[model samples]
Target: MKKVIIAGGTGFIGTYFEKRFNDIGYDVKIISRHPHNIQWDDKKAIVEALEGSELLINLAGKSVNCRYNEKNMKEIMSSRIKTTNILGKCILDCNNPPKVWMNSSTATIYRHAEDRPMTEENGEIGTGFSVDVATNWEKEFFSFNLPKTRKLALRTAIVLGKNGGVIIPYRNLTRFGLGGIQGNGKQKFSWIHIEDLFQIVLFLNNRNDLEGVFNCSSPNPVSNAELMKLLREEMNVKIGLPAPKWMLEIGAAVIRTETELVLKSRWVLPEKLEKEGFIFTYNTLDKTLRNIL
Candidate 1:
């Protein structure tokens, strides 16, 4: 049977990938801290998992949905760097390494561009804590010398899916009449449906010629104001109370997450993926919101 290994396979994205792969007849192995999964400390098991596998996906990192305090900052950086380094080492130990390795990277690596969209070929790298983390994470991932394996970094945007990801929070906001435009509502909301994201994974696995960084987002990026209006329309909510920047700051403090998650203008485009003929099922915000809602 075909084999695929997913590191940090307990999270929302990983879980979905596992199911999709399994349903399609791939033998999926998970490396996670959770019981019944291969533990991170077990290098032998990791090496075993990578050997002769068709593909390896590394999503092992701390969630960035928290206040960037001293401890969380250190953890967020270390978690990604350490796991990536370990995987690199294990791949080196493999006699027959996986054909392709897809590492998770964030679209937040690019600057908050409101004027134009950022692509893999022309995107300007941003500075700051989150940007630093993303830069270093990709740096670590590509540092490996796997001559047999193709390496690709998935710079995924906010994923919209049923019962998980940012969709749940957005759905709650719209339901409670708080789905108004966040901040000035000018921030570009770059997003992808979960199904399209999954299909991209399959597409990349087959396209052995493709490597390096690829932005995973819808081509039809919308403004924050437009996003809220569409969400209300789809969800049948008439009155959405817009949260100003000041109110968002307070709410973010109360929620223990950063405002950058919503306020930043992530205008990213999947130029490489589209140029290679990858089609997104949910290309527009309305189509995505309708499916998820």
Candidate 2:
């Protein structure tokens, strides 16, 4: 059986990938903080896992869903950089490293692009804390030189799925009646279906010629207003109370999270993926919400 190593394979995205790979007959070994898996600090074990593996996907990182306080900020950055460094070093130590290594990156690395869609070929790198985290994460991932292992950075956007992801919170909002437009409702919401994301991984792995950065997002990104409207429609919700900027700020504070997750205009496009003949199963917001809801 083909072997695959998924570092930090405990979260929603990682869990989904683990199950998918297992179903397809790959021997999926996990490297995580969990007792059953190879611990992050175990360099020898990690090297052993990566040796002769077909693929290496590092999804280990502190989630950026919480308040970006000083401590959380530090953790968010360190978790990504440290884990990536470990994986890179381990791969280097291996006699036969994984054929391909796809590390997690964020489309938020691009600026708040309201005017045009940010693609891999032509996207402006943004500023601020989240952007810094994304930039540094990619920098660390690319810092290592492993000639035997092909490296690809997955610049993923907001992932939507029924089981666990942004969908749960959005569903709750719609159920309650707060499913209206958020923060003037003009921000571009770029997202991808979890299944499509998984497919992209396989797609990249199959085509060894593809390397470097690929924006993992849907081609047709919708505005915030359109997103809320479509979501409400799908959920059969008739009444939704819009949350203004001030209200969102208050709510974010109460929830101990940041508003950038909702307010930032992430207009990212999968130019390279599409150009390479990759097709998204869930192409539009309507189709995505319909499948998930």
lDDT of each: 0.94, 0.95
Q: What is candidate 2's lDDT per residue for 1-293, written digit by digit as tens?
A: 89999998999999999999999999999999999999988899999888899999999999899999999999999999999999998888899999999999999999998899999988999999999999999999999998999999999999998899889988999899999999999999999999999999999999989999999999999999999999999999999999999999999999989999999999999999999999999999999999988
Q: What's the true lDDT of residue 180 in model 1? A: 96
Tens-digit per-residue lDDT, 1-293, candidate 1: 99999999999999998999999999999999998999999999999989999999999999999999999999999999999999999999999999999999999999999999999999999989999999999999988889999999999999988868988888899999999999999999999998899999999999978899999999999999999999999989999999999999999999999999999999999999999999888999998888888
Query: For candidate 2, what is the TM-score?
Result: 0.99
Clashing pairs in 1: none
Q: Stretches of candidate 2 above 4 Å error?
A: none
How close is every model to the real structure, measured as TM-score?
A: 0.99, 0.99
User: Cα RMSD (Å) per model?
Assistant: 0.7, 0.6
**Poorest 10 consecutive residues of model 1 by lDDT?**
162-171
Name the 10 consecutive residues with the lowest summed lDDT in model 2: 86-95
lDDT of 1 at 46: 95
